[model samples]
Target chain A: MMNKPFENAIDAHGPTVLRVCRAVLGMTPDADDAWSETFLAALRAWPDLPDDTNVEAWLVRVAQRKTVDVIRARSRQPVPVDELPTSIAGTDGIPHEADPDLWSAVASLPERQRLAVAYHYVGGLPHKETAALIGGTTEAVRRAAADGITRLRTTYGASAAQEGTR
Target chain B: MMDTNNTPEFDLASALTVGADEMDSLRSELARRAADDNLLDVTYRTIDTPLGQLLLAATERGLVRVAYEREEFDRVLDTIAQRVSARILRTPARLDDVARELDEYFTGRRTTFDLALDHSLSSGFRAEVQRSLPSIAYGHTASYGEIAALVGRPRAVRAVGTACATNPLPIVVPCHRVVRSDGSYGGYVGGVDAKTKLLTMEGAA
Candidate 1:
């Protein structure tokens, strides 16, 4: 099988993976850590990848596993004493350019709906593939993503538009 | 069945998009992390030269492949991936020194490259003959027969010609200095016109 250099894979899909991580885990060290871990894992597996592999889908799958690992690790850690309250406006506890309100709205989504949105919308995977990543039928995954979007619109869609599409 | 597509449109990706600068830094950071972990097998970048865009690829060992634009960079990358390792990236940081040296050489401010060389792309007699090319000096030309003799096989002039024609590292290794017995530019991997331009630039023609 003719494999491409792993760098091409990184260039083509790194931003999408980072976006998915941030959308799912927030723009925190957790997201950055997940992104790094995902690519490092991909780089290790890149050489032997089949020529017909859909690289973006593969990376998003890897990112899902990495994100899950981060989440499990976080659950075991004691909350920091100086942790910022989740209700704060204009801050997701990180100095990123994205609207904290929108992220907060995304954060407010149920686990299944949030994952479905992050994978199918932000990660740019089709419903079938996203279903495979998060465990459901394609129809269920599609409904979860739509429900997540409808929730976000009712919650913080005004701030997202006011902030202007970045 | 709920109409999933009928939900009011919201641009989630645009709202969540990382800025271009942030993406650049993230990629650079990952490259650094990969290098530190020994996961980056080949890092490459392109530099514009008087001839054309030159594709420079390196391993942790050293600079390995220098290819001309006409070489179809994609094909060259495929060759390196197959012959070396498939773990290659287009990172400029590893090639900064070589790019600087090439710039200096093209402007006549530098006479030789001080960068480490990687000869993994060539082997056996061809590698040996190419290894002997750097000693040919700037602003000078040597015959194929002379190079064969220099490599301790005077009767292997044809082999020397093959070596020069296939030198994986060209201008850096100074294969342009090898001429025909009758004082003509026999062949060059970068094409004969590029050979002449390099010779004229070196004032060897």
Candidate 2:
């Protein structure tokens, strides 16, 4: 088999996997756990991965399944906005000059919408793959991504645009 | 023509692009975790010949990763503060040792990784696989079944494959040394191509 292609898939798709884990597990430590588990799962299954398969989508599917398992095993509350670690938070965790409003808006999206947005924008999955991960149709994923983007626009457009204009 | 005042100044695509700074902050915060003594961080700097970038990261005892980058650039101090816990700080001078050794290896000057490894996170059979991998030697390959046999679990060849899949460290630990019994290159945590390249580079193929 093409072992090299498998390695390339891991490198190229690593961030997307992380983003998917982040979306599902929020900023909780479990997110990291899930991320590890997802890759581990991918490693075990890589020998069987179809040569022309969408590796990113495959990773997302594995990550989502692992995340669901974690969620099922735990009895914790759904991740709270306030509990998001500053490091993972939009601008509060780092010193780079980024638009806080935009990230906050992303962080503020509802869980489903947030996952959809992460898969679409951050993970770079198309609507079909996004749907598969989130358990919806392609059209539904498109709508969620669109809606999430719309929300980001509403929340950050006014202030960020004003700042840009000056 | 529409009045400029009535038009929305930014769209969704433009807004999303503005979050790169936020991602940078997140990366720095993640990097800070590497400094904790309890974190079991190992920094490796290697010239990735194919990607044409240097790779570095801090990992926990069993390879719980904190931060990684493809470049050798340093982060600004303020960014570090926001991303990592206050306990973490710029210690590039300390990391330089790793850089030096990695540089040697990339230039064909070093073969074995002489640095200390923190394998704290691994236990049971998984740890066994890690322990067994180093014995495969440079420029040699073994099958998953062979590794299983080496670990005293010949019946667990598939399980051995699982362990390799979960190998936290790739190049240093040399999971690339493992292959299929049928002369096939098996799975690699870094991806298949990376595995092939490592094998090809080492003349294992």
Candidate 3:
């Protein structure tokens, strides 16, 4: 077996995985890093992946894990201070790569709500799978997704529409 | 708003803060890393041609397969998966050299391809037959009996015909240069018209 299945998997679901990474990790270069790591890991495991696997769900799961790894790595890089400001701009810290307005909106969302929105809406997983992946019940995941979507539409969505006109 | 007419799901999914340029860059970056890590197996892409679309596939070794649209590209890919490896991807960069060469060949700017070929799909006497195809030269023709003689299997004329019919790498191998003993255009895997078109293009018709 070669990388055909792996390549096909990438082509079929690259955008969805990117969205999942971006949504979960916020719209930053870290999201790109997570996306690349997910695919690279998938490539290394391509030969062993079963042919009948649901590739979409598989990629989403991998992206989520990679996003977690990215977050962990980011946490390891810190400056000696009493308490780092939650909103560190381009001051003496590692520059965050993101559309500031876009990320701040998503960042404002509650963590579980953000994960619910990302895994369900952007990753295209059902509420059941989202719940399982995020360690919650289906009903909770659904409600989280609904609230997250409403919040995103008001914040990120409205800002995007305003930018498009300008 | 862009969402005025689209479905809610479509609107939500397409309304990402990341623009098209970012997405394109991300895809290229992923492909670059995949190729660098030697994870690419069977990469392919469609190229425009006078004979309709041609699906060009390549492996790390070289250009492995070139398929006509009528070949039902998906079915051809399945064959490649079975014969070569199941790890096929549609990466255009992997086929860039061969595609550019083929484009040059089509436009009459190049007479010979300067790229490597992977003939994994052919074997035995048929493989020998394929090896002899390029010697027939550009703008030239060779009879099946002549091919039979060249491969030192003079009596295997029908077998030669089969070899030509099943030539794994066609244009690169120049199987289109082979004709019938009676100086008639023989059968082609890409159909008689395509064969005729190739011959005409070669100025050997």
Q: Which candidate is the best by TM-score?
A: 1
lDDT per residue (tens digit) for residues A49-73 in model 3: 7777777888898888898888778
Model 3: colliding residue pairs: A2-B87, A3-B87, A4-B87, A4-B88
**Residues B1-205, model 2: lDDT tens digits:** 3332123564333343323443333334433443442321233333344425444443333222212232112432112222321122222334555566656755667788766665654568988998789998888999999899888889999888888876655577888889999998878766677778778877777
DockQ ranking, high to low: 1, 3, 2
Best by lDDT: 1
Error of 1 at B158 (Å): 4.3
Model 3 docking tier (incorrect/acceptable/medium/high): acceptable
User: How displaced is residue B168 in candidate 3, in Å?
Assistant: 2.8
- Mark the 10 consecutive residues where model 2 chain A has the least summed lDDT: A1-10
lDDT of 3 by residue, B55-171 (tens): 888888888888878888878887887788766666655577888898999999999878888989889999999988989989999999999999998999999999988876778
**How does chain B of model 1 score on TM-score?**
0.89
If chain B of candidate 3 is superposed on the true chain B, what is its TM-score? 0.87
What's the TM-score of candidate 1 when only chain A is evaluated?
0.79
Winner on TM-score (1 vs 2) = 1
Candidate 3 differs from the real structure by a C-alpha RMSD in angstroms, to one decimal, of 5.6
* TM-score, ranked from best to worst: 1, 3, 2
Among incorrect, acceptable, medium and high, the docking class of model 1 is medium
Runs in model 3 lying further than 4 Å from the true structure: A1-4, A79-107, A136-139, A153-166, B1-11, B17-23
Candidate 3 chain A lDDT trough over 10 residues, lowest sum: A82-91
